[model samples]
Target: MNTSIVGTGVAVPPNVVTNQDLVKIMDTTDEWIRSRTGVRSRRFVDAGTGTSELAAEAALAALADAKLDALSVDAVVCATMTPDRQTPGIAGALAHLVGLSNAVVFDVRQQCAGFLFALDIADMLIATERAATVLVVGAEVHAGYLPWGDAWEIVLGQSTREPSAEERAVATRYRAWSVLFGDGAGAMVLQRGAVHDTAASSGILGSVLHTDGAHANLIEVPGLGSLQRPYADAAQISAGLQHPTMNGSALYRMAVECMPEAVRQVVAKVGLGLADLDLVVAHQANDRILEGVRKRLDVDDAIVPSNIGNWGNTTAATLPILYHELCQTGRVEAGSLVAFTCFGAGAHWGALLYREP
Candidate 1:
């Protein structure tokens, strides 16, 4: 049997922080951010909000798009690195919020490879007859973990001509993370498609997922997890232990290498080649990384589409959000062969090939 992503939805916080706005609080320039990451602006959440809010909204929207009632959903799987809390998980909380009262609910943290993980799990559930419908979501509230800065005020449309008391309290730190991440959520509904579906039909074709824990340290929040409670005091915060760290050069190299290979593995598994694909939705890590993958695959611009310029990197939300936007454009019509790939903090990477219906 084939699994189909019947509906898709995305929601991003309203506040927009432009590169020009970052210049006031950081040492970077608009040209520098754009040339490096291909991101001109990104959205950040308001002070009191969290990822669950975004996830819930996106989930409901996806259900509506699928023309599915919440009660009909048999499972809710959320993928996120930035869950609102330690217990109950985002998927559990979201199930209640979205009225999937009897559904199996859980969350997975595969970093940027999260949506791919969720898709794989949902597909298996459908294929095994364990579930009739599954709702998968990828959401992030990375902005909350970023060091407080005047950029927050600027993004929120408040006066930051002078740094506010709250902004001044944080001190200048993790400038790169602060400027690169945005808050958003994206979701999709999956169901069993016709058993005889093919690339010429509308359903999933093949998928590949990989992980290398030895390289996990390349991109991580050195301070956030249970082993390290770095948010306890001012000294810890000053040590840069409260936010994520990255070996940029290493990550970029791996992403460029892994993403394309995963794409190829999935394409070949389904009896197709790069040339046969209609669209390639890659992780919104960086514009340069995606470009490297595109060149390595020898595909043209039209096949690989991107939204990193406006949304920055919403982590796990990137792939589904990109797919949702692409669907809206009518560029990926029924029966079109579409592929997606992503690499993130876990040293995790994955790819999926699907046919639209």
Candidate 2:
């Protein structure tokens, strides 16, 4: 049996935080951000909302797209680094929210490459006939990880007062990494079917995944993990150790090398070459990383589409959001050879090939 993605959907908060907006809270300019990350604006969730709510919204939209009801889902696989609680994870809440009572649910944490990992899990279940239908989602609520501190009211539009000098200084210190991410969720509905029928066949054909833990330090969220004796402390939070830090140059080089190589390897596995792929849906990490992948693969600029400029990197939600937009706009069509690729924080990266049904 083959795993076919029957529908796709995305949900992003209405709070559009543009580069100009970041200027008010952090030390940054529109040109400075755009020139580096190719992002002009990004979305942010409201103060009270969590990742599970966003994922459930996306899951419901995907179910509507697939013309399936909540009861039809057999499993729910969510990929997220930001869960509502450390104990129960987001999948169960997601399933409950969507009324997927009969579904087996779980979560996976692969950072930016999360959705790909979640998709692989859903595909495996259907391939084994353990489930005929699955719901895969990637979601993140990154506002908590930013150095908001005393500037929350200013950033969240609750107050008109300007941030203090100290607030701006602290935000600036973490802006390098924090400004690159936004909060959102994307989902897909997959089902089991014949591997590949001659006339109208569409589904995941093959995938190649790789992890290089040797360089995990390139992106580190120093505190707030099981590794720490106490998960999080006021001292750690006050010192800004809770915010994620990154070695951008190192990650850029890693992304360019791994993403295209994974694409080539997986395409070769399916007996197809890079030229056979009509579209390459890559994670919206940064424009530089995407450009490097395009250059190495030697493909036309149009073949690799990106929405990072509009949405920033929505972590795991990038692929499904962009893919859903493409499908809605009539870009991806039947028989189109599509390649999905992503490289994320764990230093996890991968590629999967699919044909539009």
Candidate 3:
């Protein structure tokens, strides 16, 4: 059986925080941010809302696009680093919100690589006859965890000596990330079908996924996981260890190296090459990373399209959101050779290849 994406959708919070707006709160300038990350604005959810809400919205929209009811969905797989409560999982919460009472639900966490990971899971379920249709969603509420501006402001206010080299590095990295992230959700409806029907031109071809935990600390929330429990301690919270941190230069190097290699692997798996792909959808991490990968593959700029300028990296939601936007613009058409890839925290990286539906 083949797994085919029948529909796609995306939902972003209405609150658009532009670079000009960020300048008021963070030590940054609009020109500097745009020059570095190619981001102009990002969306932020209001208080009291979380990933599940956004996932539900995107899921419902996807269902509507597929002309299927929520009750008809056989399963749901939500990919996210930010779950609503972390116990029941974002997939369960989203299923409940969308009234998919009977569907099997689960969550996958691979940070920016999450959406591709979730898609692979859903594809397996249908390929094995465990499901006829599945709803795969990638949603995140990153704004809540990204308080870099506030953290930096506090440090600047309380510092007595000029910050040490280490403190300066931390501040600089977080400042860059704070301007690079946004909150949003995206989803797709996948259906099982004949694997080799000549009439069918659109379906998932293959995928390649890789992880290197040895460099996991390149991007992480240090004090929240089981290894560093008691995350609620005032000391941890005050020190800002509860929020995400990263070694920006290291991560950038890793992303450019791994992402294109994964893409090459998946394309080769399907007996194609970089020149064969019609559109390359990369995770909206940064302009530099995307450009690096594109240059490494020796492709033209138009081959890889990005919306990082309008919506900062939405982590798990980036790829699906970009897919939906492309579809809306009539860019994706039947027989188009599309490729997807992302590199993220956990040092996870992945690539997927498919034909447009």
Candidate 4:
């Protein structure tokens, strides 16, 4: 049994936060941000909005593209670090929104590597005949969880409210991770059989997934869980553990070093190489990191499509969003070779190789 992507869609918030606009409230300039992260802007959900809202929008579009009713979807796999709440999973909310009453809904919390992991699981489910169609979604709302302050205020701006005293303490202690993250969502539909059967092009050929829990603490939202002692203390609040924390330099090195190898393994497993690939749709975490992997692999720029400058780091939503854009523009044609790769928190990394049918 083989599973292939039949439809794709992405939903970014209507609100766009540009670097120039950010400078009004933060101490940083547009040039500084662009030079450091290649991010000219990013999107954010409106107040009271959450990950499920974005996921539902993207999922519906994908279902429409597949020419299938939402009720036809057999399963809903939501990949995200930010769920609407800490319980029930975003999948259930999305399933309800999309009207998939019979679908088995669940969530995958692999952070940036989430979409890929969800895809892998969906593939297996389809192959095992558990589902004929699976909808996968990745959504995040980092602004809701980001810390704000004089030192870190420039990176986050004043878009969100100030953290409580406890949240502030967490941010202060974890000041090193106060900046450098953004959010959004992306989605795709994977179905059983050939692409033509599903009214799409190709199917997934092979995939690889790896993780190192030893590095889990290197990047994460630390305080919301029960593990923290003196939980919710003002000091913890100031450190930004209530939100996402990233060890920038360390993360950069890990992604650059881990992703290329993962890509190599996947391509080699499929008896292909960089030269054989038509496009590389990777996790849109950082531009410099993408360039590093490209240089290491010696792949041409044209073979890679990046929307990070416009969308920022969407975590699990990155790959599917890029895939949607490429398909819309006809960059990914039938029979084309496309490679997907990702690396993020949990020191997780993986790759999937596909041939458009």
Candidate 5:
């Protein structure tokens, strides 16, 4: 048996923040941001909306695309690093908001590898006969974490007021990262296939995920941790601990080195080679990294598509969102073999393969 992703959908906020927009409030230029991250523009959520709202909307769209009713979903797994609250997770709230009342809901945090993790879990649930239909979602509202400062009025478009020189200095501290992310959600519906199916022609062929926690500190937001006397405090905020710090060189090296290998390893699992792949829906970490993977694998530019120039890095949402957009273009032809890969902050990474019916 196989677990096939039968439907896909994505949702992004209405607001578009261009590289030109970032230059207004930060010590950066359009050329600096684009030449480094390949991002021209990205979506930012309206002031009040959070992760769950975007996830719920994407979930509903996935159900509709699948021609599925919410009641028919047997399980819902949400993957995110950002959530409105801690206790219940976005899965529970998303289930409630999307009417997936009959589904057993939960959440997973695999950083950028999140959607891949969700896909693996859904495959297990379907293969084991535990659930016939599973909805997996990847969403993030990165703006909430971006060092908004007093410039929130400008970033959120609440006011025409310009950020002061002092406000610009504050944002400059994190511009390298803040400019590379956006807010959005993407989801897909996975359904069980017939028991007679063969691995030679099945959905979700296999997934290989890896973690290297020794380097977890390479990317981190320091304020909230169980080891802290208080998970978070004004002191942490005063020290700018709420914003993330990272080792970009190390991450870029890791991605360019690891992803192509993971892709090869995953395809080999199903007795296929890199040449057999028709499309590679990789995580939109950076256009340069994607290019590196493409060049290393020696695949045609058309086979490896990217949306980072438009969406920036929506973290876990990147893969599914890109996949949905590709589907809309009718480029994923029938019987096409697609490969997915992602690497993210916990040093987590993985690659999965699937075949179109």
Candidate 6:
């Protein structure tokens, strides 16, 4: 049995924080942020909401697109780094929210590579007759942990909160990552069937995944894990250990080096080349990283990037959300060859080459 994406749905907070808005609170300007990262603005979830709420919204949209009832989904897989709690996983919560009473539920935690990983699992389960329909959701609520001080605001965005003078100084030094992230959720419904038989009229052909843990520390949150607990310090509290972090330069180099090879391998396995693909949906980490891979692969500039000018990165949700946008706009059609790639914090990377038919 072949497994295919039946539908896709995404949900972003209504709050749009523009670069100009960020500049007022931080030491940085709109030009500096736009030049470094292709972000012009990002969405911030309102207070009191968590990842499950966003995931449920996206899942419902996906179920609607699939033209299937939520109860029909046999399983639910949630890919996220920021779960409502550290345990129980967001999958169970999302399943309940979607009214899938009998569905098996679980979570995948490979960070940004999570959605691709979840899709691969969904594909295998459908191929093996283990599930008739699977709902995969990637959601994150990063605003809960934003560093509110003016020091961190210099590098991070002040859109989440007003900043003080000291916070502005700190923001200046760490502005790169602060301006490059946004929060959102995306979901997809995968069903066991032929592409043309479904509402979407397309299915997945082939997928490839890879991971290298040796460089895991190259980009990661520095505190609050099993290995180290920096909770005792006031500075650590202000820095938000549980939130996302990265070594920008290192991550850029590693992704640029690994992603092209992964793309090449997957495309070759499918007996196609860059020229044959109609769209390339790489992880929305950074514009430079995407361009770097494009240049390395010598792929055309026509490849669409779903990263909106300023949504930053939504990790595992990036590809699926982008795919949903493409589907919504009718940019992808039957028989179109779409390439998907993701590389992230676990130092993990993977690619999939599939035809939309």
Collision count for each candidate, in order: 0, 0, 0, 26, 0, 13
Provide the TM-score for each candidate, comma-separated.
0.93, 0.96, 0.91, 0.89, 0.97, 0.90
Q: Report the lDDT of model 3 for residue 262.
A: 91
Greater lDDT among 2 and 4 belongs to 2
lDDT of 6 by residue, 255-304 (tens): 88787888888888867777887888888887888889889988776674
Estimate, for each residue in 1-357, the C-alpha lDDT of model 4 and write its tens digit: 368888888888877777775554445667777777778888777667988999999998898898889888899889998888877678888888889997999999898999989999999899899999999898887767754445233333544554455545544554333234566777888887663355343578788999999999778777867787766677777564577656788899989888888888988887777788898888888888889888877899877677889988888889898899999999998779988999989978899988877
For TM-score, candidate 3 versus 5, the one ahead is: 5
lDDT rank order: 2, 5, 3, 1, 4, 6
Lowest-scoring 10 consecutive residues by lDDT in candidate 4?
A: 170-179
Error of 4 at 229 (Å): 5.5
Give the alpha carbon lDDT tens digit for every residue of 129-216 in model 5: 8999999999998887888666877865667888887889888988878899999999999997655555548677888889999988
By TM-score: ranked, best first? 5, 2, 1, 3, 6, 4
Stretch of 10 with least lDDT, candidate 6: 150-159
Q: Model 2: per-residue lDDT, tens digit, 97-200?
A: 99999899999988889999888888899988889999999998888787877687787677788999888988888888877888899999999755555543
Please give the CA lDDT of all the candidate structures: 0.84, 0.88, 0.85, 0.80, 0.88, 0.79
Q: Choose the strongest candidate by TM-score.
A: 5
Candidate number with the higher TM-score (5 or 6): 5
